[model samples]
Target: MKSVQVFAPATVANVVCGYDILGFAVDAPGDEVTMRLTSTPGIRISKITGDDGRLPLDPAKNTVSASVQHYLNALGQPSLGIDIELHKKMPIGSGLGSSSASTVAGLFAINTLLDNPLTTMDLVPFAMKGEELACGHGHADNVAPALLGGFVLIRSYEPLDIIKLPFPEDMCVAIVYPEVDVPTRDARQIIRSKVQLKDAVTQWGNVAGLVSGLFMKDYALIGRSMVDVLVEPARSILIPDFYQLRELALAQGGIGFGISGSGPSVFALTKDPETAKRITNTLQQHLQKIGIRSLSFVSSVNQQGPVVIG
Candidate 1:
């Protein structure tokens, strides 16, 4: 294939209890990248839209292009030329895994053009380069789900082990992205490196309960298990009216609500689409009442991670 276009869905990382470990893909607000092979023997970004030129065009600096470069190097073809064009459909730095989406799309496109030279799991290290370059540390909560789809658990990172979890077909999530930016680097700095033993125990219980709830298909257990005893208390203060918004969502029949990745973007899970829509509407209106204009959407869990568009 001379050219390939691929799409990678947005992901909600952390999932309240599983800090830096769990995440899931959502249907809307993803990134699309079109890659074309060239004979020039170098990587070049020909166009980028919806990011306001904030993203770098240089392959060494840009997340998507950097991932493409890594993939080429992995295939023992560092000089292979490719032209990449990015279409960012989601807001940057909104805690929605925007960078991961772009990274996954680029690697997926390149892998498709190469006719599956690498397995999906084999592309992870290359895709993670994008996250490492963006945030100064490599964490796969966002990248794993964006590449593998569905709910994922990073069981062990020492060897980069990941497992896909169960998500019921009737489940839906409401995501609200306020017109605000929370860089992951800044968000990570606010979190304390250590937690009280009590808090740590609470987090452990919640994480275990969450995993069990999903396997059991018990939505109530899942909802109750979405409590974050460590990071949320610190990171949530950065988001405006975060507590009020969660209360409103819960009141509106949302099973659970919390910050999406770090802050500024929040999500609620519901057993049905109607409840998801209601929570999204209520949250958006609440943000508006507080003079913070927001964008909200309800999406079923994305079963397919990244795929070629044409």
Candidate 2:
């Protein structure tokens, strides 16, 4: 194939208690990339849409092309002629892995056009280069799930040991993205570097419980384990009416509720699609009532990570 277009799903990272370690993909909101081989040598970002001119077009600076460049360099073809077009279908800075979707889409598209020179897992490190460029942290919480789909746990970052965890089949997610700015870089700065030993112990227990609950298909256990004592306390202040939103989600029968990644966007876990929709509607309504513009989505966990659209 001379050209390929691919779609990558948006992901919810730092799923409450499992900060920098857990994430899962959503179906609807994502990004697309179109890449084609050219006679000219070197990567070129031909165009970018849906970013409102906020994203860079330079191949060296943009996450999509930069990540693709990393993949090419790894294969010892850094001078290969290529052109990329990024289509951002999701809102950037919404705490929903916007950059990851675009980056994954770009990497997947280029790899597919090259006739699959690398496995899906092999593309992850290249994708992380994009994350590093976008947020200054080479964290895999978002990119991992966006590439592999489903729920992922980062067992180790040094060796890049990723564990795909099982989740209840009926689990659905209700996401609400308030149209506010919560840049990942700025949000990461507000996180506490050191935590009390008690909080760390509690967080560890919750992470363990959450993993166990997923494996056991225990909804109640998952709900109880979604508590975050380490990062949320410090970051919740950045979100408007964060506690009130959590209260509303729980009262509406959500299994668990918390900020999606950093702030401005929040999500609730539900057992059924109906509950997911209801929670999203309720959250959007509340945000509207409070004079905050918002976007909401309801999706079952995405099992397919990236797909060739054309």
Candidate 3:
């Protein structure tokens, strides 16, 4: 059996305006997994390091372990012994798509270690299993961007369909991950089941406008279109001074911002890298005043997603 490596970049989901439906990749901060095949029957994983002793090592319970299992099952090959070491480059549950990155990297790593039986296009559905296990809901918005790279819109989930959108060149995304974790399940629960008609109309219009803004490469319109009434208002309760921070960022040249992948982590998009830098600094300063210190990144869109390693 050949040993191989896989690398998956970190991702930011729900880029302010697009919730549960949009995401993009970032460079420098991602997880790396090393996979080696074993002659022993039955797939097993060892969580060697990273994650600050927070991740589960159980093969049956962890996302990376489960992803390898899916690959083995699909091949119908004899149970293979697989050992993986996940380098947790990013903090878990920081809304930077830590789990999705792990899940995607695991899938790609194992697929390569097994001699590449499945095509990349065919593997996204398998990668999503870990997401389902972690989030209790099968949402590919985050995983897709992590797996496929660039900006992604999950147009539909019935057939696990996804559409990739171009990342405008001038725009940059800055993210702030507060040192807290908000379970996706709990965050989902906080949202109001039914929204006011006015809010609903406004949201949908914004969604359409955002999509159009992407096509037109109009940063201002895209910034204007990022408004959420149903999820943000309800979920913001989990964060400290969410509304104030959001307003301050906007006033300081942040095109727009919303809860990033549930809560705690917040992100803003800007017209240029300067604006992105400003937004990043402003968010950090404001968040500190509220006693909520955060780690921030000023990054542009990533064109590459998860890829096989040598």
TM-score of 1: 0.98
Please give the distance, in angstroms, between residue 144's alpha carbon in candidate 1 and its true position after superposition.
Answer: 0.4
Best by lDDT: 2
Looking at model 2, residue 55 earns an lDDT score of 99
Superposed on all Cα atoms, model 2 deviates from the true structure by an RMSD in Å of 0.9
Q: Tell me the lDDT of model 3 at 124.
A: 79
The residue-by-residue lDDT of candidate 3 on 1-310, one tens digit each, is 6676678888877766577788878764678887777777765665556777888888888888887687778788637777777878877887778888888888888767656688665777877888888878778877888888888898778866788887587677777787766888888887777778987788878888888888888878888888876777788888878888788788878877877788688888877678777877887887788787788877777787887666
Provide the clashing-pair count of each candidate structure. 0, 0, 0
| lDDT of every predicted structure (CA atoms) | 0.91, 0.92, 0.78
lDDT of 1 by residue, 1-310 (tens): 3998899999999999999999999988799999999989989999999999899988899988888888888889999889999999998889999999999999999888888899888888888888999888788999999999999999998899989999778889999988877888999999999779998999999999999999998989999999998999889888999999999999999888999998689999998889989998888888888899898878999998998887
lDDT (10s digit) by residue, model 2, range 71-124: 999899989999888899999999999999999999999889888999999998
| Collision pairs in model 2 | none
| Candidate 1 clashing pairs, residues 3+ apart or interchain | none
Evaluated at residue 93, the lDDT of candidate 2 is: 94
**By lDDT: ranked, best first:** 2, 1, 3
Between prediction 1 and prediction 3, which has the larger lDDT?
1
